[model samples]
Target: MEETKDVRLALYETIMNLVDAGIHAIDEEGRTMIYNQKMRDIERMDSREVLHKKLEDVFRFRSSEESTLLKALKTGEESHLVKQTYFNNKGREITSVNHTYPFYYKEKLMGAVEIAEDITKIERLIRRNHEPHTGYTFHHIIGKSKAVSEVIEFAKRAARTSSYVLIIGETGTGKELFAQSIHYESERSRGPFITQNCAALPDNLIESILFGTKKGAFTGAVDRAGLFEQADGGTLLLDEINALNIHLQAKLLRVLQEKKVKRIGGTQEKPVDVRVIATMNETPYEAIANHRLRKDLYYRLGVVTLLIPPLRDRLEDLPLLTRHFIQKYNTLFQMNVRGITPEVLTFFHSYRWPGNIRELEHIIEAAMNVMLDEDMIELRHLPMQYRQSGHYTPAAEKSPLLKDRLFEYEKQCILEALEANGSNISKAAEQLGLSRQSLQYRMKRLGI
Candidate 1:
């Protein structure tokens, strides 16, 4: 009997010590009886200090009646899967999801056991990793417009150095794509590429998130390396740099200038070898006029500025972009969408794409989803907004003078295609599905 009891005790201790969850239990009298190593680490307490102590003695609780373990012991009721935030004896706030259960033996209450899963680190990581779409590089950029070409060429040169790059463009112009391309092409390609939007988090938390945090800095803060440290030896893209308040921008400028960052509450500055790329959706001049961006910080970040033009400004790339999207959706949707009809192409060219490439992509994706059996996208397959736009007229509303209307429509299509293609006759002819000689003759007759 004695040997069996010893074996059971050893097994229980081994099992409790090996489990990752923090386990704490108290006797019916509320005295601590089983406080495992995991629990000690979670609570930041020593076994010697807490063993056999009353639940209200070792831990600081508002009241003994409010203690979870004691409440379970007193009422024999259970509290399962509850999230709690409370300070430990060391004044460190511990956020844990706990299950406090009252165990019974032979219809008598034995005690209460609380199993805690710490989720503090998980919460922090989720906040820091909120940014999506880090996979796009320069190769993902699909436009061959002069504007896009200039930006790409400048970005390629910028990638050769570790200098700070500023990408200025309207929203949906793929600024982050350019940033990632620069990182992948640069010496820091092998290093991590981390991104954080300045406007995503509030000003209070952005500082710690960008720099770092010391253990005793905040109520629940642990010693953590911020985004700068996380992206050390690599590239960090700060999207919407103008969104950051002026004070934070000053601190960011300091880090860029010194190549080092000091944690929010720490005195020592740690050296970081990081290349930063800041992007702004609005022009820096406008941002400065609005007082949303700092002048000094703008100058520091604009050492290499790459401007991405809006899709409306480079209408010539519309046909190319449309074809590329069709091919992309063909593979993704497992359909045989060959191309868009000329009517749809004309409509696309006439429409002012305010939302830029992203909007164009969405329009194409929607068209593909609606077109099931068709190989070509027609006006009806497009969104309602497109079908009702001035660029598209209903077939029923056609004028009685068919020849004149046809000639007028043909001239308009040729003119728009030529404009979109930057007046390149060959490219415009290809886009309009006409031979170069035929396009030239038509242009001569139409006086275009």
Candidate 2:
């Protein structure tokens, strides 16, 4: 009797614990049993009522026409993870993916247990990250690297809102790509996209360009649409925003706060609604310290900040990025560079890409124009600065001792694995066939 009672208590405890995991169970009869905190609030049903009532009637799945588990039982499949949407009794739409499998008693089919995970956030996130495009949309900024992908991921989230975005990175880190992509992905995609390089224009011309003037706003000014006026309903990319003079920063800040801009030498302040995306080669703080920009304006624009990584940090994507740049310039410059050799990739991986993507793009474009369409780019085709002499060959092979070499190899392997895992260390270590500690020690020793 005690043993039977203990088993019964175990089953009850399992149900109670499962409720904490936001899981739902449906039996062969299409009954709903929600046990998570979210369900409790959504359904407003007590645990006893949930467990005692027919799941379909209480949770609103009982009368459903399509039942996933019914098919699973019919097929006698071992298990399945299915994604589907359903509506509860309150007529609210719910999107969820369910991991389901059959439950058995003494090898007999008892029913099934379904663990459903809500994916509203995930779906919204995916829509934001991917752009439906004929070309490189904001979502096309793909990277297998965490540093790059995380920024892209954040950009998607930030795009769903109207907050000002400040993108900071070194030159050639693709800040403008993000800026453009953000505009194209947002609700204002159909609006005019205007871009102004605060650094490219002189102080005198800067104001004129940002805030258009009447026919005589400046010496060469025609009645024109300023960046703000052009970007009224869309986005204005303030590229190299830190290059603006402090005076310009103050003027820009007032426009940001007031949502209006005045033309140079013009009296009227044009009411404009533009999403501003500002990019800088360095931190806004540093820009402020140097008196290059205003601190208040910096804070106002940095509500959503993204830092783009230089190519050196994400060397794993070098081969892929090389091909992408090759394809791009392949069409642009009408070159026939097929691909880069593994030897070239090795050198590409080792060499620091100071100019980042621009340097890579430039190198590929230079090599492509000079090489055959079918020619595989070798070490010689790379920039002369990237070439290595024979003097270090012997030292390269032997200087780093076996342990150190092992450390180096281990670090590379760990990094690759980590990159593959989206910077999830536990997953990376599992993939490296090493304990997390072993991976950590080697990483620290290698300064990786």
lDDT of 1 by residue, 7-64 (tens): 9999999999999998999988888889898888887888988889887776665432
Residues 1-448, model 2: lDDT tens digits: 9999999988886775656334555555555543655555534445666664555464434354444555555554644345566555566556565566776768876666666556544344334323333323665785798778888888898889878999988799899889878887888888766666777657876786677778665433446557788678888888899888888888888899889988887788889999999998875545756887665576578667787888877777887888898888778877677788888777776666668888888888777766754668887776665575631222122222223333444455557778999988778766654457866765786787
RMSD of 1: 18.7
Name the top lDDT candidate: 1
lDDT, candidates in the order shown: 0.81, 0.69
Highest-scoring model, TM-score: 1
Give the least accurate 10-residue stretch of model 1, judged by summed lDDT. Answer: 394-403
Q: Clash pairs of candidate 1? A: 316-420
lDDT of 1: 0.81
Candidate 2 has an lDDT of 0.69
Candidate 2 Cα outliers beyond 4 Å, as residue runs: 1-135, 215-222, 329-338, 388-448
